[model samples]
Target: MTNGGWFNHYDDPDEFWDDEPLPIERTPLNPSPSPSPPQNPSSPPQKVVPTPKPVEPQPWTTGPVSKSAGAERLQSGVGSSFVAVQVDAGLLPVHVQLSPQWHRHVDGSEAGAELMRAYQKAIGIYLGETIKSGKYFSGEFRHPSAPPDRRTVLMLLLETASWADYRETQTRIYARNGFEVHGQAQIQNEPVTSMRANWFQVKSIRIWPDWARRADPIQIVDEVLCCANRVRELRPTFKIRGDYSRYSDEDLEYQHLQHRENLIEELGV
Candidate 1:
């Protein structure tokens, strides 16, 4: 064999290829999506509210007042033989009981006068008892020697003057308005009585004794009370029409002192 072509270098072939390294492959990535612009949240709807108002006052109105204790019926008679009279708180006669003996004793013409006398007696007795009970006059007033203080005296005078002025004003108003109310009662087809009243007091009471005598006492009293109540119901409301404004306490006291001095001088006391 030819030595140059046939015989190659075989002793170090594996050792010569052991020093080289291998290459690696990779894929491309997609770009991320742009973030959305920030937005403001809508504000919640708001609630609403409201306001309030005021009140007013009223005026005084007069009407029937409740009767006092033991004021329902007050009766008086003379010796059980004469006539008897029953009256209410205002001393308005409600009933008259005439005995047979009284009717026989009094002449037919004198019956009305005798009944009136009995009514007067009843009023007197009622006033006496009222005074004794300290109801009519509550010891507020005293004799000149034991008079109340100057302030109290002035107050009393002012109150009296105020009441008088009010009464006078009310009277005029009643007259102008024709504020009289009338009520009547009948018994057994006969007219028994007719009552007339104004805002302040009973104006007139006309009774037919002949018809009233025939009716029961209780019935008569009931009729009278009914009439009185009717008058109250029918009484019209009126605005208080008086200059109730009063002088100052100092002025009232000065006037009282002056009056007292004048009285003392005039009486030479």
Candidate 2:
């Protein structure tokens, strides 16, 4: 409200700072002629602390991990490596590293689940017509690593499939459309104790990454489908190598027969 601020009476903040005296035309060499007050006996002398200069931060260095003196040694390419998921795409398994971003794309949403089911049914149809003879039935599976907390299935294409001999078990799993059924035929008066049906085994299963370490089969199937579709889109038939022509069933059986004959000749059995 006033023409000048209330602070006009005093010098600016700079004059009062750093023990600096008020502005004058000239600084006198002599001391002021003021009477000295009586010194208090209780006052103690204060020490002046020297200000320290600030230190600059050092630049970061990147090299091989430094090992402690007693650190256990690890072999080369061991302990420091990570495995990315690779689904078979023709010759090589297509690599797909699992990450937070990738996790969103294949979260087994409702749509994805339905699509996977359709693919599964189609694969089933292919296997149903391909495998016929009971002698070709095979039952062997590698134990999965990090078993999924929930049941998950992986639909695979069999390069060479054949039905194996029927075996009886209490497990009533072979009651599906793909499975051939008999109408309660009496075997030997053993009242329906065991169910006899054909078991099919594929000579080759589509390659997958180290599945023992896989935790989610659903994620695996999703990733595999992504890889397969991508490869198929790029190349109509993207196959690096095939074993069907190289090792036919006849050739394998002939080798087995020859090996058995050689063993019989040596052992006289």
Candidate 3:
């Protein structure tokens, strides 16, 4: 029974011709290219960080300065009345008042009395006692009792020069003495350089007069007479214009008109 044809097939070691049928052959799995090991992620292309830009600086400006760099020490409010004038006219005596900034002496002494006496003398000279000329001079010392600590404001006239020049000199004097330039007036035909002159007269001398009396007609006449005499002394031969009418009582009234006319002549305005 063991060799009888495929002994009931089940018992046959090799049934039919060789195996049931030839087994199919499989192709080699082409090693999927090893997936390139993910290329090590290429270090994420070295996250190139961008460079920062530079900032520029700006310029700094300063505000207004409170005080002048080299201002002089003055007797406080007294600076307001420190009037100076340059005149073609000769030296003329006049009165002046002391600045309020002058402190009174603590002790009543002879020296103080002497100072007061000198101040009185100055006043007398200003009031035409020393001035024989028709020109009038008048001023009063503010602190006659305390002359030791007081500053004086003198009123003097100049003789023989043009008024224009005189006015300029006066302005320069006060300017050098810490007085600010307030205003300037120009006069035609009277080109005096002195602040006392019409051309360069200060519009308003902002001083609180210690002597509260308004300059009266008598005082004016005396001043004019003294001024005229001063003019004679300055130039014995040259005629001096002693006419007060020539100078306007109010310099502001026609200052602009005068300045404009002068400028028009100078710049063909």
TM-score, every prediction: 0.33, 0.16, 0.16
Query: Which stretches of model 3 miss by more than 4 angstroms?
Result: 1-170, 176-242, 246-248
Tens-place lDDT per residue, model 2, 150-174, is: 1111100122121111111101222
What is the Å distance of residue 102 in model 1 from its true position?
Answer: 7.0
Colliding pairs, model 1: none
Best by TM-score: 1
Candidate 1 lDDT, tens digit per residue, 76-164? 33423467876555555566676656545655444445655666666656654554454545553222122244454454443333344
lDDT of 3 by residue, 61-114 (tens): 111121111111111112222222222212222433333322232121222232
* Candidate 2 minimal-lDDT segment of 10 residues: 148-157
lDDT of 2: 0.31
- Model 1 ranges with Cα > 4 A deviation: 1-82, 94-114, 139-183, 186-191, 195-205, 209-219, 223-269
Worst ten in a row by lDDT for model 1 = 58-67
Number of the predicted model whose lDDT against the real structure is largest = 1
